[model samples]
Target: MKRISRREVLKTTSHFFVGAIAGAGLNSVLQGCADTSSDQSAIDDIMKKTEMADIKNIKLTVLYDNVLYKKEMATYWGFSCAVQGLDKNILFDTGMYENTLMSNMLKLGIDPSKIDELVISHDHPDHVGGAMMFLENSSDINVSLVKSFGSSFKKEVKERGLNLREIDQPCLITKNSFSTGEMKNFTKNEHALVIRTNKGSIIITGCAHPGVVEIVEQTKKITNEDVLLVMGGFHIMNDLGTKTKKIVHRLKDLGVNFIAPSHCTGGEAIEIFSKAYGPKFINSGVGRIITANDFI
Candidate 1:
């Protein structure tokens, strides 16, 4: 992990439950996602581990995605990212297949054992399928997911002695990291990751089911900072020609400095983004590694 004195971060357990925003309206969008006492305990343990570690540069490596940047590794219709330089190493999502996800991670020189926790984006096969394999074989590390997940899946995770953090609201993940809780709207249940950097915030989505533009807007509003970058699946594969023109422009309008659209972001949408972002566009795919320093 990398270290440097940070500007401001939560240092006590009391601050952990309040969430990225105390009451960011949500306008009842996340309706029916209630919480339990045990669920609260799970999240507490996951966030309290390394409050001492300072953040410097956050290294985000796309370990698994639909696009292939390095032909040496296998690509699948899924998404996963390796988050480094924080207090604990985090695997953002598990991808579609366990073997393929693991193979690509090793090919990229990432050690599975070094991951301290796993933050699954949603219940989709492409996102959570590979997780079962890792969770069954691993121990000690925490698995953070939405509280609305099926009981059988949660049962299996607890059976392995792996800590489970049932996320319901935006909360701290580690020192500078946070989960947008779980947003549900057009698609299904999903969440984005937020890493507070010195410049601004880096917001990562699994399949912006709740709307990519909305996610960026809410994060910027909650964090009180402009978004430096927005990466991961935009899930805009089905839009017609030029339909995404406004979305890309809206992102740029939202003060997003860099854009990395991968996974389900579709080729047409990617092209439009490239034209919109110009030099700031990143060809994000499997094996692509980006750091906060690269943009800063």
Candidate 2:
């Protein structure tokens, strides 16, 4: 495994979740349905949904996990992200192993009780695998664990007396944060986090099995803000020479400013991004910390 810093690992997994690969199985369903031509009108609508002044001092920290680092992280860890501020600490996804996630959080100085909310990106083990551990850590607080499905994990949560909200409908978590709520339109029952930030809306995804492109476009539809940063697994590593280039161009055309592709993103894709985005492309790894403050 590459010697990735903890901060790098954290930011890469800021959007950790399980999703299907685009053009692999669900491409036809996603491609034929939406007219890309209408994207401009949609952008306009998104801009109209909120005022720029509404965004404030929101800070996100790449907390724990591995898949976001591209290399099969040491097997001691999985993929997990910690979001701080906004009056709540929302943990997006948990890695495959509970011990690794817990130890990483401890080494990184994150307390589970400080986490006000827990959101699951999908049903995959890597994403929700550490839920029971998280709940066990925060037994004192009425922490809210949100997910689209009433996963068997729900039983574990309820059995432990943790508050679990099986979200079937889209709902707001904070002043400007929104959840995709299972994203039944796509496979893997994946969900992503859309956060309003000072620069613009930051969309955090896990695995992006539903298609990274589709995730970004859907976030634009829901939040109506120019995506400032998209950091997480793109699940597109097979052909970096051509496909990554196309995706980068599309993201540019869509007005995305920063991208930190990790986890399932192969080396070739990382190379393409490093050449294309340069400094804007972050190198993520376990034990590293990244935030908007660090950017400025």
Candidate 3:
């Protein structure tokens, strides 16, 4: 596992974010702890007998519909995330097609073989373009392909015998989930999807393009935690005045509670992250349904 060179892994991940900003900004500390509240009914009464894993009842369906879905065309956006479960139904990125993402996952009834897992965050095509029509309509849905543009698409992803894994680092996928591999690349091949939830860390990205605050400071420096929720795309469209309010006050001084932001995250940068995270911001498209029990 000494194959570095992706331009020296983006210069050693930008020198580990400039030596973690003089030893404390390891993307600005988090050390596990996140309940980024708008007080979801007091976090639903402290997770009300929390032990969520087999997805008791969850749903986030948006097969693919650009223009950030709404908010009046929000300066043209793009993203496709479909997450539903009672027992493993996931489809992170697959917009752009698949018959309009299987007629918007059959108008959100979602039965692409109960969609086990299909994470393709990079290799754009509006995020793996409906992932080969969800493997041509569920070939026993068990996909895990997460490689970013290399090995030349691995022979049509190994002739669709997929279950591929080209993730270069950071692991776990089920079991307090994680996956930030092949990141720090800047141009393409970017990655992000860590979900450790007992109260913190629920990062998910698609168009971050390497710097969504450096991919949530490299997933809290590879899981030190507390980054409650950092939805998607903060590519900061053309940095308007005061550098987008100092990048939303440096993501609220790195205590990032919640900031949905879809597609290229424009529309005046979601109105400067809704006036610098006023209500802890929210607006992720395609039938939103974000949960956090530490991603079970």
Please rank every candidate by TM-score, starting with the best.
1, 2, 3
* RMSD of each candidate relative to the true structure: 12.3, 11.1, 20.2
Residue-by-residue lDDT tens digits, candidate 1, 1-296? 11111111112211111113222222222222234244354345434431422225578899899988877879999899999888788999888777889898888888898898788887776777677556556766778887776555565566556677777776667677777776777557777888877767888889888889988876765565768889999988998746689898788888999999999999899988998888888889999998744673
lDDT of 2: 0.60
Clashing pairs in 3: 25-28, 34-199, 94-130, 197-294, 198-294
RMSD of model 3, in Å?
Answer: 20.2
How do all models score by TM-score? Answer: 0.80, 0.73, 0.29
Model 2, span 1-296: residue lDDT tens: 12223333233332322222222221111011112234354334334443332333555555554534323323333457787666567887776666677766776778877777787776666676666566556653332334544434455455455555554344455445656544554546576777777687787777777777878877776666678888776767677478788888888877788887766666788778878887777776555456664444
Candidate order, lDDT descending? 1, 2, 3
C-alpha lDDT of residue 104 in model 1: 89
lDDT of 3 at 48: 40
lDDT of 1 at 250: 88
